[model samples]
Target: PLQVKRGIIDKQTGKIAGEEEYYVDRDECNRADTTLAGLLKLPPVFDTTSGQGSVTAGNSSQLSDGASATLLMSRERAEALGVRPKLVFRGYAVAGCEPDEMGIGPVFAVPKLLQRHGLRVEDIDLWELNEAFASQVVYCRDRLGLDPEKLNVNGGSISIGHPFGMTGSRLVGTLANEMLRRKARLGVVTMCIGGGQGMAGLFEACL
Candidate 1:
């Protein structure tokens, strides 16, 4: 069984991220919680493997159609255009893992990104770890010592379907808005790639 997690929790305002897109698909949209009774009813998506394979459709991110976009340019350029900046691109890092066990990509990538900036998990004020699957997300959460309080304060891909091309930018968009509302400093958006790779980026809200 996996921890049923959906919706981001805004630490500063104590609000839950519940956009209409959170449950775009009709499959069990906002249907159940972490109750054992509720979990027992979710259907398994994959067959039982030797040591792993506990993922179920309920705990997995839904595949659906979506799109997101962000404009990246210099602050001077934005100012010249009278456009308000949202975030600053601080740094980025990527790492590889076993393709079959790609869920742990963030586990390796985030640490490298953090070390690059001489930061620790505690230094991050917010996180958007894509919920590709409950299995890998949980593994990263525990392994990275990420604060559940700051992680995915709004609904993640588990709630809203993941659009591969735009997910990373989408996460940065979500993080940028939340960080501004919360008036927070550092936020990190990390997710495991479909293949055996993992990527993470460091961002600072332009406040």
Candidate 2:
């Protein structure tokens, strides 16, 4: 559900934070066509439609000319620079998987990360699992027993175009902002990499 600051909602953003419902206003959307009819007229990325197969243009992440960056430094360095940090990187883990099943990478990586920190799935306050695909996100949620309520409260890569190399920066930046807004203690940024691997990074609120 959208946590609307105003009681009224319509022509605002969306009712549910998902891939399809997200709106691309004015200059944000660089797609050839933004209309529903134009989108429907386009062919699926795969041989089958969404009803037949999980892969579709709607659920897939597209590469765009997008960029995001974050300043990273040790606690001492931050202190020396007089820069108070907003979060601390607790742990990160990467796990291998079949190339074809790469989307399931988080299922393995998340456990390793949490286990290393003596934490559990339930202990996580928020998650920014990249929406590489709906199928993968759904699988990771069920396999890892993640709470949907605590998952991607906002739409993900599917809604926001996925810019390849900047995904880490983008996800982490978004995670940090949301964590601060919600006052969440633990937040995770995770995604499945191409060539059969999944990566997850755990973070804790510092300030």
Candidate 3:
């Protein structure tokens, strides 16, 4: 599923260059160390009760190895280099949250972001909220009243794989590309950090 999505995006942008083997595969699924099946069978990290623990390998992000890069340059520089720009970096915000409830990072970060830019949630055309965990995504979506249709249309970390440090850039790249493809105006990319922090950035698709 993810490979097909990447293929389509690669065709559209030609930025990804080519496919990589980091994506999950049948051979990797058969291996004990790298398999999602093996991870799902282990004891619960938080709650032990059946179907009670909110965090699980199935719902949580996969620990995969990958890398992504986003080229940030001024319009003048890009034009001088004869390259087409995709999106304009509007603004960004960072907010701290309780370490225990770190998953709720976006809940606080997003408001600060909007207020700083003097914009409302409805002003944004698309949103990419990292699926670090299913619980976190659900909580943010309900609390923020995000439209399902405007969110992560091509799936997220849970479906593809979270490469930890690479996820922020990955989200930004995905949002920019999708915004351009849809001819949308505004887009936002937000993610919850590991140690009680959230970061968000807003962008405008270049037409």
Candidate 4:
């Protein structure tokens, strides 16, 4: 489903440019190495100096502000509301990282949640990654070996506007709808937050 959208920075002018659609192909993503070394435009995870093993890099500023919300009702509640419920939250997890390295939050959170449910990362059929910054999502993808094609089918807030106070629900609804569209059974939503929090939620489409 469409999860996040983003734009490019024109280095010469130091301004954001027109946004574009980014997609992850599930098949291609799972086959890559642990570092996801094959992706064409992946964001850099660490900086290396002369003969240095590894070093941290600064955060990217290509992020926009946005919010989303979704309403979920129990089976009984749905009946009372006179609406059919098509999905349910299965589980959720959150992780922390250095504030400046906030992009890696999802990488830690998703694996733990998936393990808690006894589900392998491969078991998930779809994914929605909140595009806080292009680098944030890319960092998770490389670290987690997530399939880019299966990552975001619709698009993201980068292309759409990030309307604060509504992104969570928006992402949930979009993922649920995408699951129904593909007739898939499982989906996951993940996002990186400011100040070092990474959040992820798992869901299944109800019959």
Off by over 4 Å in 2: 1-44, 47-51
Q: Which candidate is the best by TM-score?
A: 1
Can you write out model 2's per-residue Cα lDDT over 35-145, one digit (the tens) per residue? 777656655566564555546676576665467989889999999999988889888999999998888899989999999999989999999888567778888999999
**Clash number for each model:** 6, 0, 0, 27
lDDT accuracy of residue 125 in candidate 3: 92
Q: Say which candidate scores most in lDDT.
A: 1
Q: Provide the global lDDT of candidate 1 against the true structure.
A: 0.84
| TM-score pick, better of 1 and 2 | 1
Task: Give per-residue lDDT, candidate 1, residue 98.
Answer: 93
Model 3, runs deviating above 4 Å = 1-45
The C-alpha local distance difference test score for the whole of candidate 3 amounts to 0.82
Tens-place lDDT per residue, model 1, 1-207, is: 223436676888889955333433354434555676777677666875564557787788877655688899998899899998888999999999999878789999999999999999999999999967877778899999998899888777777667678889889889999999999999999988877889999999888
What ranges in model 1 sit over 4 Å off?
Answer: 1-29, 32-36, 49-53
lDDT of 4 by residue, 78-185 (tens): 888899777888889999989987767888889989998999878999998875455667778888888888887776544444565666788888898899988999
- Give the lowest summed-lDDT range of ten residues in model 3: 22-31
Sequence-dependent TM-score of model 4 = 0.66
Deviating ranges (above 4 Å) for candidate 4: 1-69
Each prediction's TM-score versus the true structure: 0.80, 0.77, 0.77, 0.66
